[model samples]
Target: MAKQQVISPLPGTFYRKSAPDQPSYKEEGDQVAVGETIGLVEVMKSFHEIKSDFAGTVTKFLIDNEDAVMAGQALVEIDG
Candidate 1:
């Protein structure tokens, strides 16, 4: 199996769930499909959905929920 990384598209705050009380978009060990939303990035009050570019099992999240992230920062690692 090879590992792939999901990168942040823009500098902002990374959110694992759509809302505070909702479940996370993807958890470790979860199977993710291409174009699946794994998280969101909030910038200047605008939210952007972060989607996967490849299908694989979610292996790990590099940053915690609501953590600050930069553009092109590695967020999640997926195993294929």
Candidate 2:
């Protein structure tokens, strides 16, 4: 099996939700499809969607929510 890559589309702090009190966009073992929005990256108060590059089940979460992330950063790994 190959691990699917979840990439950050911008340089910012990656957040799992629109608000702190909200649940995460996704979690491990969750089935995801290509082009699906998995998370958000905040840059200068603007949020950008981080999408899945492949269809698979999420196997790992590389970065924690609210963590500073760079462009192209690996956010999650999925088993494809």
* Clashing residue pairs for model 1: none
lDDT of 1 by residue, 25-63 (tens): 999999999999999999999999999988989999999
The candidate 1 region of ten consecutive residues with least summed lDDT is 47-56
Q: In model 2, how large is the Cα lDDT of residue 27? A: 86
Best by TM-score: 1
**TM-scores of the models, in the given order?**
0.98, 0.91
Cα lDDT, model 2, residue 69: 93
Question: Which 10-residue window of candidate 2 scores lowest in summed lDDT?
Answer: 1-10
Q: For model 2, how does the per-residue alpha-carbon lDDT over 1-80 read when each residue is reduced to its tens digit?
A: 88767788689998878688988878888899988888999999987888888998999899998899988789999999
